[model samples]
Target chain A: MPQREGSPWRGLNVVFFRELFDHLTSVRMLVLEFLVVLFGAAVVYFAAEQIRNTTAEDPFLFLRLFAPPGQSLLSFVVVISILVPIMSIGLGFDAVNGEYNRRTMSRILSQPIYRDALLFGKFLAGLTTLTICLVTLWLLVIGFGLLRLGIPPGAEEIGRLLIFLLVTIAYAGVWLALSLLLSVVFRSTATAALVALGLWLFLSLLWPALAQMLGGVISPPDIRFAQLGLPTPDTLAWQQGLSRLSPGTLYGEAVVAMLNPDAQSMTTLLAQFQGRIGSPLPLDESIVQAWPQIVSLIAGTILLYVVGYVAFQRQEVRA
Target chain B: MTDNVIEASALTKRYGRATAVDGISFTVGRGEIFGLLGPNGAGKTTTILMMLGLTDVTAGTVRVLGHDPVREPLQVKRVVGYLPDTVGFYDYMTAEDNLRYTAALIGIPLADRDKRITSALERVGLQDVGHKHVGAFSRGMRQRLGLAEILMKDVSVAILDEPTSGLDPHATSELLEMIRSLKRDGVAVLLSSHLLERVQSVCDRVALFHSGRIALLGTVPELAREVLGGGYNVEVEADGEGLALRFSEIGGVKAVDQSGPARYRLLADRDVRPQAAAAVVNAGGALRRLSVEEPSLDAIYNHYFETHGGQNAAA
Candidate 1:
């Protein structure tokens, strides 16, 4: 490409193209992409088949039992939650430190490109790869949804899915930034990888359980608190409020509210949504209801990413 | 020299309590092969790194091509090519691929890259080995490949650290020849090497680095003149005793030594050869042998250690 004069980011295009070409041509990403798609398709096909065999009388209801009514979007969201973090950590974690170890950082830093270009190039590359993977997963899910339901999703469903994708991108951005930050913070690839993996595991899997344990320790179920306890009506509300502090649970709750707009009552939010289109509820109605949790997820993702970017910018590239 | 290619003024680098490079100042003139001669840990690598902007300078300024390296690093780095002492390449790539990668990374034009790559490899005498995997190449070949990579930049200055460190005599000769060729092309080279003889032969000037400062800096001939004055010896079969009497009478003759029957070595300040030869002829003696001795780089190095002491010899 052509270099832009008087621009510090002139060589940013070079870093971008280099990373994009390497990732696209790499055997590991190609193999993982293929395996993840194939596995996801197989699982969706088998689940659709099983739903057809048992719940043929009322497919929508059966779908509601497993997912929300008229939408098997839960499968896609769950798959994304699991795979996005993996893609994030896999692509990053070595972006900076690996260059230092390979002695290529000297060559790269010696170029006209600033360090900002290098960091931004890596961040964008990882985000772009994860987005492509998520889009592929979306197409497959919608294709299967059409085949099984014999109906294309309407404007409302598509809009919700789009929102879901944006939120998912934000979520992936958090981890991408974290991985890049860790890559610079550590001198070795293995150490950075371990730190990234550990963070992913804590946020995705263990964070919710740890929140519950904290809740129990702070407000034990057996103890009779005057306001909020097991026997008291406020106990459930207390537990729900405590659980929202976990990032995983907060993101899951936001996805549920976005997917099931009619599930207004807290009890039915978990039971499953049953609603039709054309008598569309105001977007704010659902947003206001889930505003606390969704805002938390968005804010958390942005906050984490900013911290990572700042740390990365301050890191010394010398090994 | 009116054109100074590289200049460092009191450049210092300290890693916590340890001072890696300590207030070393030197200037390299355009098209000159300037050698930074020092032992290991004499801050040669650190000095090179600081000049290249790879490490932070704790104290003073470094100017390359009239740009402060720390502030206007990209400007200086763009026009300067550096080869670290232990050059490491992306092992999975072939020689051509590696060079092409470097060419692209440095923003070499796509249209001219192939020609540049071919010419650079050919210059390093690696034209036949261009297709081989760099990982499989011998250390000498790697060194040549590293040189080729820098040569593609066609930079105004080249900083090389121990370019012939692990090479055999033949390989070292090839590398020295390559460096000398760069000088012919008007590329100013600042290299640190332990090969004193090669430095003495190829470099027009040198700086003997000790404890992060230049102990001596000048042309080899200029240094030889300072460290070693004029000296000569004439061995005669006959009339040598009378010749000594005549030469001692001459103001130019300083001292005389006799080792054998027809062998005598003399020390003097100026050319007394015509007078001494005439004195021998007049005294009826045949001048069998005549020679003059000059100090070698080895002796200068030994003198450096002797005067500077062993503690700072390898500084």
Candidate 2:
């Protein structure tokens, strides 16, 4: 669709292309890109190794790379969940504050473009750059699988692979929006960057533990059920549900569901599936199951981005 | 189009308990050079920000290009070019790249942007250094680049906030000359500066700001007359007291005092030169020197500031 003339979108293309150029050439993104591919490839190697050790007839060998391994090495999902935030935060922590530091904010805002175009253009540019990075990483792992494990992914696995990439992009959007918001709130670029990384650590690593503790405190295991030798399934369910509030958990659930067709739910449920057949759900069913997680990731992105937008619009351009 | 490119009436801005600009009103006409001359914190910057709609007005109305900047900022900004005090540019970018980014932001079409940028650089005398990174630029050079940005926009009104705040005498004069050229191009200029002499020299008229109020406003000579009230300071030096006595006999001399040996300080209601000089030479005294000192912007500014109970802000 054509954008209306003199609309706020008039400058979006100009801003987006310029920011994209900077993001592509900047050393900060380059270093983060190297770390992600390096760490990501290492996990892919271990997964390929695990698959090779297993039966040659294993149909889901390529998909196992995205799941947690039986061994102690970090899985592809965990590595992606950790790395996406760092990459995203690096891209956006300096987005607004760096403009202020460089003294470009006043000059740019004085132009004919509306504030809407400037902020929206920045976000879209960051998301596009992230998409490019993730696509390349996904291709690298799949290529490795093809060359080392000597297995090509089937159509169902390919569908799951596509969904995983989308989920990863959405997760990156959430962190990118957060970093942009921090950039607008804090004056110093370094301060914003530090706060964003600290928040990431709290969310990914610390929140799960805190949520588990808080959930247990909030809903202590029923003593009668414990005395009957039955697990306090409700308390555990609530704790896991609270843990799922984290983007890391959402991403973990999403990628695991996409990468493993045999896996039905994110939680363990051997007791509930005792009489079930060995047949796995189709790719569509898995995606339908992951719809809530996908929506949450996107919703989180929108919520953060809206806040950043309003703050940026109200900010005084003077140094 | 109205003669006033920028019009503000009862413009007010307050920050909680403190009023930054209080009931200020001014108009900037096309092809006119109007100056907001004031010392620091006299509400000049705040007024400029409110005019540009960078800050909201607490009360009252302001229009740039007949559009309320707060309601139609893009429309106002399109025709208005602002060079803020000590404006910064992208340090990593070359001068051309910095301009290119501005062109993109201003929505200058690609086909004509290069030509406009080239001319702007040429006009600002930064053509030779267009490819050098702005980080390496001297402060004066960066200021000229700021002018180039203003030129590239082809804006109708150029608002410059303290454009020569930190420039050397050489750079300051050069920038003033370039600003005069902006007038020749029929662009309205609203420049704020604390330098009364520079403002008086360049501006067609000026408003003297004192403690959030316009203490005086008019052409330089008019303001001088307003504050000095038709009185001119005169000095006459001769070898004899005859010159002092003859100077006192002049028609317009209001008062005479023998301030030094054979030197008479006289206050006159009119140009005392022809009458005082004639009197001195005709008196058979050696008229060593005679000077009729017109009131300067400095004295006028000081008079207004003093009357308004502000600290003595000498130019």
lDDT of 1 by residue, B64-123 (tens): 988776676678778888876667777777899888777876789999999999999999
Q: After superposition, how far is residue A54 of candidate 1 from its true place, in Å?
A: 5.6
Instruction: Give chain A TM for each model in order.
Output: 0.78, 0.92
Candidate lDDT scores, in order, read: 0.72, 0.85
Best by DockQ: 2
Q: Candidate 1 docking: what grade?
A: acceptable
What TM-scores do the predictions have? Answer: 0.80, 0.93
How well does chain B match by TM-score in each candidate?
0.85, 0.88
Give model 2's DockQ, 2 decimals. 0.49
Clashing pairs in 1: B42-B315
lDDT score at residue A137, model 2, on the 0-100 scale = 91
Q: Encode model 2's per-residue lDDT on B1-315: one tens digit a residue.
A: 878998999988888888878788888888999999988999998888887767777899999989888777788889999898888987878999999998988878899998999999999999999999999998899889999999999999999999998899999999999999999999999999999876577999899887777778888767766776655788888765466667778886778888888888887767788787778667767777888876678888777656855343342
